[model samples]
Target: MDNQLLLSLTEKYGSPLYVYNADKIISQYNRITEAFSSVKNLKLNYAVKANSNISVLKLFNKLSSGIDTVSIQEVQLGLEAGFYPENIIYTPNGVSLQEIEQVANLGVQINIDNISILEQFGHHYPNIPVCVRINPHIMAGGNHKISVGHIDSKFGISIHQVPHIKRVVENTKMHINGIHMHTGSDILDIDVFLAATEILFNTAKEFPQIDFIDFGSGFKVPYKEGDISTNIEELGEKLSKRFNTFCKEFGKDLTLMFEPGKFLVSEAGYFLTHVNVVKQTTSTVFASVDSGFNHLIRPMLYDSYHHIHNISNPNGRERYYSVVGYICETDTFGSNRRISEIREGDVLCFNNAGAYCYTMASNYNSRYRPAEVLLYNGNDYLIRKQETFNDLIKNQVIIDLD
Candidate 1:
């Protein structure tokens, strides 16, 4: 939010940099906690794959949030960030039994999706507490690419497969401590989420030994001005009342969990890039930046909208220009976008870059990845250094063919 700080970061870290505000992350976490203040048993697990930077994980650690990891590497990163194994949950999908065992060895909670791996793992480790991911057969989410709870999705076991799951549990005598469901991402409708939660709770009733139910998070954040987002306050009130009633009926206190990623950090990040050229074409004006999809690919990949501002010309006259990147491919960030007048060498800031932007960056054109900075407590800390040419060739085995 501070233009001076952004300008200073551009000067220090060079162009095409990612800067995250720790204050914003903390504020968002606090907001979620405040909304669910009435809930007796609640756990907020921060999804690590959304942004795996160790610094970012450490910030969540400071907030006392649990870590939700999708890989063994993320589990290690969470541990390196000072989170205990009990505070981490490994919810990998479509992975090998060896990989699941590797993460389980670290003492974190294991959430199995497929029946094959679950059967194998449950048979071997019957004493270990595990969670089963169930598909509620409810269609939810903002986009098809993000929706994962539908019948066609490969994410979780179908609700109709409950009999099969129960058979496996009975055969292995495995301790099924939790039930989980992740409908999708970018969900703005609170009623749909609550509907999915009701399904999860109903499924939970079938498992008497269950200690928790994970209503996988897809709480949306505003991408642009006036954009709709999940109403956490209303959802909290409605969901809490239902959850309490369910707990009373079940005669036990069960933990309510959410694995939120974008909701916690989407608005906390800013991607800054310098304008390389301002070319005036016949029908359209082009504002080419020094970066490309290599640095931020959400726009080209998902048609995601990020508010672009000419930080160097915030007060300049407004104009319509096609903001593009330097990638060799036709990587258009925005077409016919109305922003403050852009000029060569001027810096532009992309809003809502916190969640999936940097983590998805790639060196497609062999371009160096930008540096990362974390702005916390009114100070800037360099989290990751800019990639160098040597990094590109670090793993390539060069052979001299004579």
Candidate 2:
């Protein structure tokens, strides 16, 4: 995005705001679609947990991409965003059978991860089609916290439990329609993903009634310039060939589904915060901002790196400064980072902030969350309004102790 545009947004909406480029999101989705165009039956399910904003979901819905949700509320949001029931997939991990049943009632595809809930749900609703989430035991992702398919991970059922899954299916007469596996996020290794896919394909053979194989997505996106991202074109070509060959061998044509969240929206987002103070400590200089972990917590939570830019002073000389926040804790966004010299009240933009940033935000320290804007079709729309003080205590009740 141009500096003038971001500057205008910062001036209009105030600082500590989230700006998403809808065009960039569409471009990313189109890139994936083009890469996998050779595949006859393919579905891209946008993982709603990444960014559950209804406007964002509506944009994907317009693109004909299916929605992948982790909760019944998200399923409702997807429906509210105009996605058809059959186009949404509810893939919750460690959730209750009641929640699964609630989502199933929404008419969306259900993906069960554990055996206990799977057996119970199947016993109760044998005719409903369901998908099984398997743990491939593959260690992949940018960090351990983001990785979910490791041997000890609680995200998916153990592959060794295939027999038990079969038992549940046979005893309950459940219709198992799909097999799914998600290695992790920020995965750069294509071979690792392919290996997981092979495992999923082999497991799918056990269920001849299956109509699809969901190779859950973790395609990495560049957080900074020169940073490596997943080679989707290469991955699409290779995986498509293998998938088609497998279908021919199995004598059936089935859909290849992927639930991509971060890969589609991360780079399209920019978090803009204004410098509140320039504090000089004993040994280092800190450029404190008006936002904290309550607004963007990727750095504090996962030690994630987000490329920082001084959009307010892009032409200024670069220097090293520790970017901190005003929260009551040691909330550091970046430490000793090189950026255009920052001045008090100058705005800083955090790159790759679209996916987990706002969705994971909280009202910690009683701070109001920032607003959101969408840059689409050469126009800026206020997708969300900034919270007020009343929003902080909207749900709290006071007792009269007089």
**lDDT of candidate 2 over 333-401, digit per residue (tens):** 999999999999898999999999999999999899999999989889999999999998889997899
Q: For candidate 1, what is the TM-score? A: 0.99
- The C-alpha TM-scores of every prediction are 0.99, 0.99
**Regions more than 4 Å wrong, model 1:** none
Write candidate 1's Cα lDDT for 1-402 as tens digits. Answer: 878879999899887899999989999999888888877999999999888999999999989999899999999999999999999999988999999998888899999998998899999999999999999988898778889999999999999988889999999999999999999998878888888888888899899999999999989999888899999889888888898899999999999899999999999999999999999989999999999999999988889999999998899999999999999999999999999999999999999999998899999999999999999887899999999999999999999999
The lDDT per prediction is: 0.92, 0.93
Q: Model 2 segments beyond 4 Å from truth?
A: none
> Residue 92 error for model 1, in Å?
1.0
- Residue pairs clashing in model 1 are none
True-vs-predicted CA distance for residue 73, candidate 1, Å: 1.0
Q: Which candidate leads in lDDT? A: 2
Count of clashing residue pairs in every prediction = 0, 0
Evaluated at residue 330, the lDDT of candidate 1 is 93
